[model samples]
Target: MKNIIKRNPNTMPKPVGEYSHVTVIPRNSELYTFSGQIGNDLEGNIPVSHKEQVENTFKNIERALLSENLRAEHIVKVNIWSVEEINWDHFDNVWHSFFETNPSMTIAYISALGLPEIGIEIEILAAKPSE
Candidate 1:
């Protein structure tokens, strides 16, 4: 198994979930950075609801991670963008369901997305520890 280390300082707000605010892996490990994913379904249609969009965006990230033999737990940093601000409680429910254990996250509220219905966008940085 790969060893991991948390790097958040005690002065910072405690993580609201099961993740540390930051993590460090061995220097030799392979790393992957994924682009921001929107809610577009496989058929090229964006979902209409925030929940649907968030779920699809996460699923897309999962697929990308799987292609590299990684999972959500391997993710180290996540940057999220939402139209207007997030509905925190609603977002928390969906987020915990997908991530199970949270990862380091940063969220921003943007004025708009190219598609008006797109309420959220997410990008991720992940690393797999070396054997």
Candidate 2:
């Protein structure tokens, strides 16, 4: 079952893109926050295309969560920052393909990043029921 309730109230303007206006996480859940994940692959090579960068970044996030025994389903929130202009089509394509549940996401087009090779960075907030 989903531990968060994501919604866009009718009274408020619909989100400009694929995201909810509000996200509500249940009480007593264990929250895990990850640092910004970049698109660097195992060989430390980052692809030049924003699409590839976005794809690899999500893959890295999966690998990171798995290291802690968590899967994509455990993620409650998604946040992304891009050095280039936001490409909704390509971004949503990769994002929807990766995550079955549309967790609330915050994405922005930023002017710069930590590394010149890194075109995109993503951070995620995951949760699990407290034992």
Candidate 3:
């Protein structure tokens, strides 16, 4: 995280949520781009409720990060897409539990995701300095 730079410029309006507007990764860092993660568990079970799905999605994301030897601090950007309205309160609660340094993020409400049962999907870009 010390290698990453987060900025919110005075020229732009304040962000409405717990995220920065820009993120800069360290030079020669190893970057990871993940596929959008849904609420499916390791057993491939997708939850029915949006809240449950949201929680599961983050769990999956954590697993994904760990697979690459990365942690929340290594994240530089996040993108969220939802078919249903996001519960910001619950979302922020879950988000805060994972991220300490605010990361650049974007969210969009869409008609649908990869599957009808999927209410939300999240993807991330992460960077860590190369040894």
Could you say which candidate leads in TM-score? 3
* Top candidate (lDDT): 3
How high is the CA lDDT of each candidate model? Answer: 0.80, 0.83, 0.92
- Residue pair clashes in candidate 2: none
TM-score (C-alpha, index-matched) for candidate 1: 0.85
- Cα deviation at 14, candidate 2, in Å, is 1.6
Predicted candidate 3 versus true structure: per-residue lDDT over 47-125, tens digit per residue: 8999999999999999999999999989999999999898889999999999988899999999989889999999999
- Across 1-131, the per-residue lDDT of candidate 2 in tens digits comes to 44667788899997887677776777887889999999988898999988888888989999999999988877878888888885778878987888776677888888889988789999999887665
**Alpha-carbon error at 24 in model 3, in Å?**
0.8
Count of backbone clashes, every candidate in sequence = 0, 0, 0
Relative to the unseen true structure, what is the C-alpha lDDT of residue 62 in candidate 2, on a scale of 0 to 100? 90
Instruction: Provide the lowest-lDDT 10-residue window in model 1.
Output: 1-10
Sorted by TM-score (best first), the order is 3, 2, 1
Pitting candidate 2 against candidate 3, the one with the higher lDDT is 3
Better of 2 and 3 by TM-score: 3
Number of clashing residue pairs, candidate 2:
0
Clashing residue pairs found in predicted model 3 = none
